[model samples]
Target: MILSVALLVPWATGAVLVALDGRRRAVGWLAVAVLAATFALLAVLTAQVLAGGSQEVVTGGWPPGVGIVLHADMLGVVFALLSVLVLLAATTHEVLAGIEERVFPGLVLLLAGGLTGLFLTGDVFNFYVFFELAMTASYVLTAYGGGRRQLRAAMVFTAVNLLGSFIFLLSVAGTYRVTGTLAMLDVGERMAVVDPNAALLIATGFFIAFSVKLGLFPFHFWLPTVYAGSSPAVAAILSGAVANIGAYGLLRFGPTMFPAQLRLVGAAIVVLGAVSLIYGAVLAVARGDVAESLAYSAIGQVGYVLVALGVGGPVGLTAAVVYSVVNALNKTLLFLAAGIRGPLVAGAFAVGALSVAGVPPAAGFVGKLEMFRAGIVVGSVPLIVLLTLGSGLSLVYMFQMYQRAFWRAPAPAGPASPLPLRLLTTAVALLVLAAGVWPEPLLAASGRAAEGLLPGAAG
Candidate 1:
């Protein structure tokens, strides 16, 4: 029941918000309260899971293998918590910035709800449903502001995502036809016995779908334009919450269903990731807009996760999990800070830029270090070197953007009122960074989540 509430709260809240007049300030508060409550519930659920309580709820009284199952295992909880935190921050920031257009808050809540469902679902078909939910809400939000650039970006984003969804559906159908089960755990157990060629074809479908979503090298055409065109809050959600689904899918499906194929194909992924790291960084350095640069920076950051996944050891897997959480927070902060418009905005951007550059004591630094260590243990020396070069490039581009945005004199000073909401949001982002710097709690939580997948390593 609690798990169901966690998945449904956002939609429920969105319904209530929709019924209210959009012109009133109270609607925004209502939306915020709903998200805050949802966050509280997730925190409590995470605590219970950490205490070794099982967090599975079966719907319609169906058996575990056949039922719609929602499980808050470590992986699910880590992402759920992240989605809640980012959504809350974005919502509050929007409310404060007086950008509380009626549909905006509701759409964000819907997006969060979809993500919650995605994380909790234990069935493959259900995963697709939730994926569509999240993607659809995001599409609407992308074009919500009604600018020409946003509209164009949203169209590209929609077409690509819809095609990915179709591929995902075909994969799901193929898997079900081959194994006679839609439950992910059961499918994994049965996959080893399926025809080798059939299995490979089905797995290929999943790979192509997730690759497009994650913006892997050849398929990443939509990322820069979307990030550059969307509002800061929307960009934060896409990079932080939405982008993670790709990595999660790889972790969930690849190891369980295609271990042999993964071993065979892993090197290709590693190579692509390495190329993305260099390609994205070099392009970022060549670009001038702060948001566009960060957009490219995300490409490199996500590539690190890909490299870790390709390594396929316990340490590498752990690094990937931790890196996802750390990178999500860091990216969210960087994107949000880029939206600041006052004299102090430059300082805010600098703090965030330095953090993303893997400055000491920050979350990015910890994640990067762990990943490098994992690469060494896995004998992926080239990956380790590429990651180092990537980090150095990140520092160069980020600081260059910082220097231009802040240290460069602003066109003659003009009268302007400070945005209180933006300031508050920046404060929240700073606090999030602080948590990352001293990330004992999040790391412990992540360790517990990683344990479910690697039971032997769950110390």
Candidate 2:
């Protein structure tokens, strides 16, 4: 019942918003209120899943194998909550600033609906359905400003990601043809008996699709222009919320559906991740624009996730989960802060920068520590050295960008930022600090989420 409500509220609200005049403050705040309600419902659902176990419901009371099953476990619920919080924050930020587009509020609500469904559905085909829902909203959201630059970014984003989406659909077709099922659990169970050659090809297709979404080193050409061209709120949603699809897909599909293939290609994945870290960091140092720099930095951040995944164990998986959560929060804070200039905004940016560099007193340090622990557990000296060098490069670039952006006088020419926006960033920075100082809960949650997917652990 809770699972159904969690998925429906945002979806229904979004539909209503599409017909209404959302440019009015009432409509916009109503949208925010609806999102807040949805977030509350999801929070309750998360607590229920954490306290009891996975909560599942099949549509129309049909059998699990036939009906669409909505599944909420520790892993799915956590990412869902993280994504909603980001949307909530971004929406709040936009509301305080006054929405420009008539469709802005509706689009955001629809995007939330899409993201919620993607995180909860148990079927791969439903995953694709929700993924398209989210991506479609994002495609329009990218052109929010409707400037020539924004239109170009949206076009490129649509073309590149549409290709990735087709590849994903191809993989889905292969999975179904080979396994005779669209349900993820069924696919996982059956993959063990399927021909290795077929399974490997399907896995590679998924890897390519998600890599393009994550802006991984090789498939990342479209990201910089898009990020640089979009408005701040849209950029935050893309980096902080939408990008979760990639990390979540890799985690779910790799461990749950293709564990054997993951094991076989673990080293190659690690090599790719290492290259991403080096390439993203070096390029970030060279870019003059903050958006472009952060674009490359986003690339560097996901490398840690892939590296941890390649290590392939309880420690490695937990590290990947932890890093994903922390990175989402850090990016949300930084992206929002970058658009605002005021007193104490610099401090917020500093917190985000330090977090990215894995410095003390920020959530990112916890992620870095686990990655270090994963490297040690794998006994990979090369990984350890490479990770350290990546951190060094990160610190140099992050601080250099910080000093240039924040330490300089705010242009007397530009309008001052709103108090509400400044407060939002400050609050996010404080949350990042609190999580770092008291990381036991985040650590335990990551471990439990990983265990739910790991071999010999509870599902």
Each prediction's RMSD to truth: 2.4, 1.3
- lDDT (10s digit) by residue, model 1, range 289-393: 888898888887788777877787677777778888887887777777666655556556666676677776566777887778888897767777888898899
Clashing residue pair totals per candidate (backbone < 3 A): 1, 0
Clashing residue pairs in candidate 1, if any? 74-449
Q: How many clashes show up in model 2? A: 0
The candidate that wins on TM-score is 2
- Candidate 2 regions with alpha-carbon error over 4 angstroms: 409-417
Query: Which candidate leads in lDDT?
Result: 2
Worst 10 residues of 1 by lDDT: 409-418
